[model samples]
Target chain A: MRHISHTDINYADLFADFRDPNSGAVVMFSGEVRDNNKGKAVTHLEYEAYEPMAEKMIDEILNAALEKWPLNKAICVHRVGPIDVCGCAVVVITSSAHRAAAYEANRYIIDRVKYEAPIWKHEFFTDGTSEWGQNCDCSSPSHPHHHEHKHHHAE
Target chain B: METTIQVTCFAGLRKFFNCPLTINLKLPTAYEDVLLEMKKVNPEASEILDSCRIAVCESFVPRTALMTSDEPLFIIPPSSGG
Candidate 1:
């Protein structure tokens, strides 16, 4: 029933909201924080978001996922705040009559969510270096924001 | 009528814009029009002027989306977070 939560999402309760006898499979995927950042010691992560807009974009993706897949239950959870290594950063759960829908819808949700979601995270390195990951693929050449034919700067 | 917008920037974006996390604007006009007007308030707003993605009421909307919708629009900078 919960679409998004700023606090640590109770992922178990979230998936239970859609559990039904007819649903044969429930697949849950969690992306956790890793302590190693390409051989460098990783510290913690700090995430931020344009809350209102991020929520709006999430609903659109949810609607599209519902239409494209035969999923009876879907839950997407993204954490915004500081998190230590090995903590759950993102969670996606889906239920269907078969494993295929669960697998496909889960994949679709993860990929699309990563590319379209408006959340940002700053990776703190043990050596005092920090880097940010781009949340959207809007910079892609095929993006609608791109000029139809001209290959100009991707703002 | 005046409306407010909250923006959160990431990555190198913070280096360009000072870190307060959010900027509140009260503009007596439409969403698209307000964006143009913002520059007057802070010349630095140009960093997000035309290229930023805007979300209104829990949904990302086109720049052409009307400002007179049922809910006030919220402006967001390009997302550079994972």
Candidate 2:
């Protein structure tokens, strides 16, 4: 049960934090800001989150993944504020007794993190314009329907 | 029976609502119900909720996700960070 971090991530420390001798497989998934979005060259990206609620939601997603799979330990870390291009956006580490559970849960957590949490990103393009994938006029409900997403770290 | 629920909203989600972080709402309220009330409070926010997901004590509740459970209901806004 952990959810705290800054833009600077030490996977070495993070992996060491949750790994155990009994755990055979340690799988992690990281979501990052890519240089391109929607066929546009991205210059940078901005992320905004509802901290408390977002944390609560993240915990829920963690629990859902745990219930859906088997694992020795699970950890999720997300970043907030303006992120430079290629920065780590989200991190999910799943340590399980087997490789399959660790791998499966790792993927599940990232997908759920995007769909379940309320964090918005503003993608800045090479043309000096940006678009928010989850932006609204500040009106209407946000259903987690989008499927295509980018991962920061994998395997 | 009605009681008061103290909810602390944050980040992008805060911008979505018209109420302050610490506001009084009826207790025994589900997360979705509060979201509906949130629509009235912030019509701008309601649109976002339509596609959003919620959590009660760290469990993802679908659009059909209800808040009838007891204690600790958090409405998550979209976020991405490491």
For each candidate, report its DockQ versus the true two-chain complex.
0.37, 0.23
Worst 10 residues of 1 chain B by lDDT: B20-29
Each prediction's fraction of true contacts recovered: 0.51, 0.34
Comparing only chain B with the true structure, the TM-scores of all models are: 0.55, 0.62
Query: A1-155 in candidate 2: lDDT tens per residue?
Result: 44645466566788887767889999878787788976999988777766666677678778887898888888888876677787887788999888999998887777667654667676789998866665322243653344322211112
How do the residues B5-27 of candidate 1 rate in per-residue lDDT, one tens digit apiece? Answer: 55434444556554433434454
Of candidate 1 chain A, the 10-residue stretch with the lowest lDDT total is A145-154
lDDT of 1 by residue, A114-142 (tens): 66667777889999998775444444675
Output the worst ten-in-a-row residue range by lDDT, candidate 2 chain B. B18-27
The candidate that wins on TM-score is: 1
Give RMSD to native, each candidate. Answer: 5.5, 7.8
Q: Which ten residues in a row have the lowest lDDT in candidate 2 chain A?
A: A146-155
Instruction: Please provide the root mean square deviation of candidate 1 (C-alpha atoms, Å).
Output: 5.5
Score residue A32 of candidate 2 by CA lDDT: 74
